[model samples]
Target: MSKVVINSYEEFERLLGQQIGVSDWLEVTQERINQFADATLDHQWIHVDVERAKTESPFKSTIVHGYLTLSLLPYFWNQIIEVNNLKMMVNYGMDKMRFGQAVLSGQRIRMTAELHSLVNLRGTAKAEIKFFIEIEGQKKKALEGIATFLYYFC
Candidate 1:
């Protein structure tokens, strides 16, 4: 893997509108979703009951919870190119978010982020990255959001 280096805030701003690479696909397993449901106390039939899903749910299969899908971001994001020599980076938070479609269990998903905005926060760089959570081969987006991250150089 190449070491991605950002020498200064200007460098990150220069990356605006550029498409970061597609992350490796993450499989949405029923077991994982079930575990998430159990942990969150969300035992909705659409998420936990496979038999009922097949018969009643429009997806015809158990689906991963939207929050679970969102929570998987850190794993999917690690596949992104990193800034070499950066001291630390923080998940500052998201500015806006929307769940566009359902993620069915047994499916795979990946992310494509575009640098949308960059601002200098004194010594740190604050960036707004728009992410499209893409389900392989699907035209509809599973999730869309503008995530903010702060990168500080020591």
Candidate 2:
């Protein structure tokens, strides 16, 4: 999908209350899951130990970490929109985040985002986006949250 380009805050504000876009599907590979485990030092058996997880896990396989899925927000968000002429951009925070389901390794996930609100804070813009990370062919979302970003446009 083509990115939704926003050259200015006004352009971004225009998308309020609208479903901006959906990102491309990204596979939750075991390699990526293991890498995240190593990076974070969260070597839980459900995430890193493939053989144990196959027999012990309710999902019957290794599952991706919740934080690992949440960390993909930026990657997925980048796929949906591109804001140019920015002096800086900050990940302000996230609110009301919930993990609805476990993402099994090798499953594909994609994000769909809506512009929840946009506030002009002096010269900076605060954008609140409602996002859902959907597992392929699943009714339940892998994760859902409202993410806020601070953008300084030049």
Scanning candidate 2 in windows of ten residues, the lowest lDDT window is 1-10
- Candidate 2 is scored at a TM of 0.99
Question: Over the stretch 1-154, how does candidate 2's per-residue lDDT look in tens digits?
Answer: 7899999999999999999999999999999999999999999999999999999999999999999999999999999999999999999999999999999999999999999999999979999999999999999999999999999999
Separately for all candidates shown, the number of backbone clashes (residues 3 or more apart, or on different chains) is 1, 0
Note the residue pairs that clash in candidate 2.
none
For candidate 1, write residues 17-85 as lDDT tens digits: 897666888898999998999899999999999999999999999888999988887776667756645
Pairs clashing within candidate 1: 4-84
Off by over 4 Å in 1: 1-8
Please give the RMSD to the true structure for each candidate, in Å: 2.0, 0.6
